[model samples]
Target: MASGFNQKNKQCSLQELAALVPDGSSIALGGSFLHRGPFAFVRELIRQEKRGLELIKQSPGYDVDILCRAGVLRRVRAGIVAMEGNFGLAPWYRRAVERREIELEEHACASLTAGLRAAAFGVPFQPCGGLHGSSLPELNGWKCLDDPYGSGQKTWVVPAIRPDFAVIQASEVDAQGNVRVHGTAHWDRIMSRAAGSVLVVAEKVVDSAVFEAQPESTLVPYFMVQNYAVVAGGAWPGSSWPAYAIDYPAVEAYMDKNSDLRAHMAAAPEAQEGNHG
Candidate 1:
């Protein structure tokens, strides 16, 4: 957890942020598909060589794939894992699952969101509809319950999915840890609330006055952030909209040369966000 709920000034280096998640943690990643991911923070986690971690995300692309390549993940709970059109698939993630090197517990997009909502709302479970005619409900151990008011309709109840941490990418976060995310927060609010703690990887760390002047822009409040790091272009090779777009060439090159990650990363400085606080 964070130092304290009331503790201010959560800014730290990427390494310090990564240190908070120990081995065997079940971590929820922010962003959807390839946009606005905490790639820089993910890189630090790999560099630190954290092992036996469980990844939880509704949709993941580069983050899950790289972790699979690094042998950092033991299990994954996600609805979809793939690189978009620029790249057809997350090859390393596919290979790992095919090789039975790790475990996967899949969910539909709605089901996963229900689970997060359950945890965030401090409920035992949340009722989910639209999962009919699918095996995922049974496969995921979601219980079936009859509608209470004698309506006789049945729904799936997803047990609370409380991850150890939620790591998010932000457009900006102030020294006090108030976060601002410009485009496509993409279930980040629910993910943050559902997790035990939150870590933010930000494009810039600004002054608290910036947030005070525009409180409505604060997507994540100060108390919710355990720690954060300032990394310009933190989401590289993936888009952090209004700032940059997906680096498809870099991504394709990564798929080809990932076996030599050190060499590949040397050519893409934004992948590691440089070694600065």
Candidate 2:
């Protein structure tokens, strides 16, 4: 956790921020399904050829699908990976798993949250009885233990999943690294705490005075943030609440199984200079 102790301006370009992700690193993505997920950053990873990444998210769609198409990800840990309704499944993700090109470890949303919470709490594991009647515990080999209080109840505990980094998309961020999220945080807060460090992708950059005036509104205090980038439309194709909504046409093109994503990749600035072939 970088405490912004020096009060340094943590801003950088999208390429600079994405470069911090190592090949084969385990990274947690903020947002759920199609909303506010960092698709722009994912594109940069593909362009940089940051291969063998393990993506962790509660729900993901376009980001994971495109990563799979680019052969950038080797494994995925998530509850469910799909395009929000009407678009149906994340076609590329399904195809990759079906072809055995990617390893998928599925979990219930609750189980995943419990695992993240445990890591954020600085604990090795957390007990959860929510997995009952679900095969996730057995499939993932989670440990089942008896309560120490003699309650005669068994609790299933999941191992902590600490990612090397957590990438979050925020509505606004100050030069000092303080972030303000206009809507639901989803699991971004927990991921920030559970991760080795946090990288924020913001839609707008405001002055430090805005934060000092209302410190309580900061969703991710500068202390938990390590680095950040300001891209006006950073969450493109995904909704950045209070600013914009999901872009349906872009999503449709992405959902089209025939698309090679070369066109889409060429459109993003960070990927334009790199060879997408």
Most lDDT-accurate candidate: 1
lDDT of 2 by residue, 161-232 (tens): 899999998988887788888889988989998999999988878877888788888888887888998776
Report the Cα lDDT for candidate 1.
0.86
**Which segments of model 1 are wrong by more than 4 Å?**
1-8, 257-259, 270-275
Q: How far is candidate 2 from the true structure (C-alpha RMSD, Å)?
A: 3.2
TM-score of each: 0.94, 0.93
- Residue 269's lDDT in candidate 1: 42
Tens-digit per-residue lDDT, 1-277, candidate 1: 1323356567888778899999999999999877999987888888899999999999999999999999999999998778987687899899999998989999887888899999999998999899989999878877899988899989888989999999999998877788899877998999999999999989887777778788888888988888988888778878898889988877887888435787655555444445555
Q: Name the lDDT value of residue 14 in candidate 1.
A: 79
Candidate 2 has its poorest 10 consecutive residues by lDDT at: 268-277
